[model samples]
Target: MSEAAIVIEHVARRFGALEAVRGATLTVERGEIFGLVGPDGAGKTTLMRMLAGVLRPDSGRITLEGIDVAADPERAKTALGYMPQRFGLYEDLTVDENAFFYGELFDVPRAEYRERVTRLLGAAGLAAFGRRLAGQLSGGMKQKLGLVCALIHTPKVLLLDEPTTGVDPVSRRDFWALLYQLREQGVTIVMSTAYMDEAQRCSRLALLHAGEVRECATPAALKRRLPGALLAIAGSDPRAIRDALADAPGVQGTLLMGDRVHVRVDDGGLRGPELEARLAERALAHAPFETVEPGIEDVFVALVGGAA
Candidate 1:
């Protein structure tokens, strides 16, 4: 097998004059969960669409395994399974019926289809609800059903575009469990998500903003790359405290977190007495300050501005 399960090189996409994806490039290893992390309108969905052979890029190349997607989309299509952000499943059809319909689309044999459907339904915890109509299921169940439908044919590559956008906490947990199970079976997954926490769960991540990749690395590696030390400051008025520290000398960035203010500064410049003296001079009552490790969310915001 090739070292890369998927390769995107100098890929650019344009709708008229608007460049949705600008020179985007990345590679995914086989059997790994590679993530695209960005906010809405960051062009992740457009990039994923090109990889799935649904849309052609304006320039550059996309190859699944080793075959070029544009050169032979049908071959790429056969090996790829795509779940769009809002997947379409027949509301009137029962769970089993929906699975059967999709299995046939992938041209699975009747015998193999039956076994695959049964296993997928069980794995999604929908075995007992096979007879229930899709419309009657919960939001999470609908999402799982969409996933099972996409997996009916067991394609080598799986593409999911924001698969868990609005799901509840419990449903989100179940959905991630499903991804882990697929990973164990050696299925390579490339997904896009807006949730920072979800990005931490992947083997590696590509942080996209403003239609470009700012950084790509394991979550731990990204955290370790923070530019400076971080300190947590507490005061009687947390919001006021944050405002006071925003433009203070040595403060690089000040972000409010719950009842405390997260202060970023040059390494070794942010100290307890310094922060306390500053706050006290402003006639503010604040508790003792302490340093804390930076989190992915903070790192993401600091590295990629909200505009991106």
Candidate 2:
């Protein structure tokens, strides 16, 4: 068996004049949960679509296991299951019907789909809702059903695009539990998410920005790679605090985390006084700058462009 589950070599895709993906290349190992982390327009969806064989790259090559996606999508899809951001679940159909629909699409035998859907629905906590209309289900429940449908054929690789977005905290927790279970079963998973916390759950991550992969590594490694030291300053208005330190020398970037503002500096101890001095001019009442651990969001904002 090959060590890699998915591989792409300088893949490029475009829609008219818009370059959705630009020379993006990454690899996902068998049984690993790889995350694509980036903001909107970062090309996460485009890259995912290419990997799932829904769209072909205009240039370069992409292979699922050993099968080229562009050259032979049908053969590649036999081992791939894709759940787009808005999974095409028939609103009027029951959960069972939806799963059956996907099963038939994948050409799974009726007897096989029956057992598989039963187990999947139960594992996703949707056993009792099998007869419930998809339109009536909660947002999280719908997402779970979509996942169940995606797994109807038990594909070797699963690609989920922001599956947990807008879900309640408890539901999100439940969804992640499901992902952990899939990982244990040795199912290779690649997903894109806007949530930083979700990105941390992956085995490794590829940070995309402006249709390019800026960085790729484990969560801990990405945080450790954050240049300079991070410091937090508590303030009544995080935006104001960020603005006040905007022109502070030696500061690399500033990010707001709730009521606190995180600023990266060449030297925290030396720059602390300067940050204070700058804020003092604006009469902004802010707590002392204290060293803080860097978060994945911080690394992303530092490497890719995001709102201050």
Candidate 3:
């Protein structure tokens, strides 16, 4: 295989007492959608900023597409498209104007950007809204416009920071569909998302927790890292079921999943009946316990020893 699109070696960043990212190391293959999966304050943004060359790491190194980000940020940026959590679009400007502004920032010529922006806008489903003020667009539309602006220069690597947070479920689905389209065109995308479902879409993932890279693998591989089988016991009292299974035999951990409590046991076939019997003892009427497959969040939760 060719060299990876990005390579990070022992990268670290600290802010006074808080070390935002700690000795992180990973590789992103070309044209791969590599996800930095974690919750808030997990240093996804810090690591992304370092990758964008906007923030310097306190120690270690980062390289984007063979260019050292810290040593040659300007050159690195030419091949990078960064869309931060808040897409920094000029509110007073129309969608077309905002694209023009970013194009100018990237030093793309008017003739080139005009033609390029048209294609990008059309691809992002914002062709008809070119004249609409950025401030007037809906949240989902704003995000799409932000994406359009980021792609104005047609960079090789796209860095998105939680691009779907707070977006409507339908809009989120649409946004991901667009990302998949980009992937098919051979763009190397390194994005950070707290949504485990979103993380599942990545070609491979690096699970970040408290500034540390917990694991790096495909979504299926990560789920397999979760030792033991999963048993989803649905009950009106999920909390009660979860608590009741805490000390149950062969149980590793328990988490409340809305109306269901997903309990991790050493063996599902062996403990499934045991768990049901234990719940029955407490008079908690639960749906027939299902030996379910674990998801990305379930693995993350099990890895972190609780909440995901």
Candidate 4:
């Protein structure tokens, strides 16, 4: 097995009356992409902040490469790079200038800083825009610049809090490509995201809800954990079919997706005839229903819908 790059043990954090994080525990293995998957207010940010050594956990411990974060935040930080939801980029400064500032802050030697900056900028496709003011760049370019600054000092682990939350789809793809390249170079990444599809891309995932980890495993394993087979019914009004099948026998859960309603049933035997009977009773017999492979979003809904 690969060595663990980060570990959290029964960590909890509170803000006044709110329990932001509760007894969360997980391990991120070296040279892998680990995703913190959850919706807003699911304690992802709180947990990430604790891991980044920015916020002290009220209880429990966090370790980066066997160094206790709370005990020596400075030492822990040296080996880690954290990009919060809102990465601080000086809009007035040019891209090269921003990289220079961060390099200086990290006390990187002048010669090494120049060489690293050139390589990083080239890799990020930002070499052409080195002299462009950050404020003048597009949202995607700005995000890329933020990433460049974070990597200026060559940290071993990278922690990102929803790095692609507001980025365009193309940019999100580009951002993920960059992450995969970093992983190839043996950097452990721990990132939190609300996007279920993005969660599917991670090598391992921790599904969190209401400040607690609901499940943690590889994406395939988590999807397999879903209790039943899923069927997709395409129709004009999914909400109607969902309501009609709410109390149907063998039906576990029904969720509306786009123009289709995903129905979870106890087994494959419940599909054709049994499902048709339920639909016919509600005059939804014409709607097309077929068995479909369950996605990570389906698993997340099945797990969190009840508690929600």
Candidate 5:
């Protein structure tokens, strides 16, 4: 494994009566995408802000590329780019103008700025929109522009807070493509997002809730942490099937997904038949049931539900 580009150690932050981050700790390996997955009020933003040196943690330590962030914020920030949920962009300025402004702040030479900006804009699909005012772009385009601005300085690590929250699906897809490209270029990315599917794209993720770290692992590894086998049943009425399995023997939990009901069985071999018998008793005998792989959302619900 590569050296960790970012290290967080038992970090805690509080705001008056609220403990926003409680003993949160994780590491982001060099050149990998690490995701902070959680729901609102889960402290994702607070944690990211602390990492970026914008907000200091009341306890614990944060280090970027081995430099202590709290002890030396300026040195730590030089090697990283922090993009908050609402990136501060001059709505009145054109996209290119905004990029240039950031470039100037980072002190990139005029010639170097021109070369990097041209490539970055073209790669981000914002080359044509360079002349468009920042406020005129759609939600996705605005995000892409924010990303371009954040990358203008070419920092070693990038921290983004919910970059795709309100973006359209297609735009979200485009944004992720840009991230992958950056990863390929050896940029370490640490991002926070509420989207479970988006979490799947991360190389590794830390699942958080109520300011606590529930679990941290690769998406596949996290799914494997699920207690038992997952079984999906599709019936004439998926909701009926879900209800039928709600408290069925050997059924750990049940979730409704599209036209199917996914039930976590304590034992695939032993509980599979029991589930069928229970469904039969409930007049759902004809429902189709098969053991299936658990998705990240399933594992998240299982872990968080159990914690709750």
Candidate 6:
């Protein structure tokens, strides 16, 4: 197993009277894909910034590979690559030109830029579009170029803040592939995402809410933390079923997933059949309901007291 690459100790950051990050403590294993999962204004970006040595913590410490980030930020910067939520490329510059610009920023040798640029463009599936102006690229392509620029220096730790916010599904897939490729090259990635599916892809996750981490564990471990069993109910309007079950006798929360409504009950052994009977009484037809494992989104929703 790899060593721990990042350690956040009682880290807290505030903006005016608002606490952006409230004593958030988490550890990221080296070469592992760790995630900070939460909604907007959940302090994920603030935490990532502190870890990347770009934003200083107000009350606690952030360390990377045992080096104090606040005290030795300059030295830490060289070993960290941060892709902020809005790190955009110069619109007028070509894809290749942007890569070269970032390479120079990292002090990469001019003679090696061409080879490195080729590899990055190939990895992003933009090898044939290197000469295209960044402004001409689609949202997905722009995001890819930003990622390539961030990786130009090949830093040991990569910190990405919602790198797929506005990207299309296909581009999101490509972005994750690039992340896996980086992990294989021994890069430690600490990323934040509002998408629950993206959080499910992480090896380990920190579920954040209101600037604090509510749970930290693997996806399986987190799901197991859900208090009860899940049952999928299919009906005409799942949202209506969801609303109806929110305060139902023994139900925890009703989560809508596509055409089904996941009803979380306190006890599947006792309430499983009983809940179905009640639904039948209301003339609300549903498919065969069975006890099933809870998903990451379910666990997160339950942990955060139902989504926003």
Taking all chains together, each candidate's TM-score versus the true structure is: 0.94, 0.97, 0.97, 0.96, 0.93, 0.95
Give the clashing residue pairs of candidate 1, or none: none
Candidate 2 lDDT over 53-132, as tens digits, reads: 98989999998979999999999999988999999999999988898889999999977877898899999999999888
Q: Against the true structure, what is every candidate's RMSD?
A: 2.0, 1.2, 1.3, 1.7, 2.1, 1.7
Clash list (residue pairs), candidate 2: none
Per-residue error for 46 in candidate 3, Å, reads: 0.7
The lDDT leader among the candidates is: 2
Q: Using TM-score as the measure, name the better of candidate 2 and candidate 4.
A: 2
Write down the lDDT of every candidate, Cα atoms only.
0.88, 0.91, 0.90, 0.88, 0.90, 0.88
Q: Give lDDT for model 4.
A: 0.88
Supply candidate 3's per-residue lDDT for 90. Answer: 89
lDDT, model 6, position 125: 96
lDDT, candidate 3, 94-192, per-residue tens: 999998899899999877977898888888889999899999998999999999888888889999999999999988988998899889988999999
Better of 2 and 6 by lDDT: 2
State the displacement of the C-alpha of residue 256, model 5, in Å, after optimal TM-score superposition.
Answer: 2.3
Q: Give residue 137's lDDT in candidate 5 (0 to 100).
A: 96
Higher-scoring candidate on TM-score, 3 or 4: 3
Would you list the rank order by TM-score, best first?
2, 3, 4, 6, 1, 5
Q: Write out the backbone clash pairs for model 4.
A: none
lDDT of 1: 0.88
What TM-score would candidate 2 get against the native? 0.97
lDDT of prediction 6: 0.88
Between candidates 1 and 3, the one scoring higher on TM-score is: 3
Better of 1 and 6 by TM-score: 6
| Ten residues in sequence with the least summed lDDT for candidate 5 | 299-308
Clashes of 1: 0
lDDT of 5 by residue, 150-224 (tens): 999899999999999899999999999999999999999999998888999999999998999999999989987
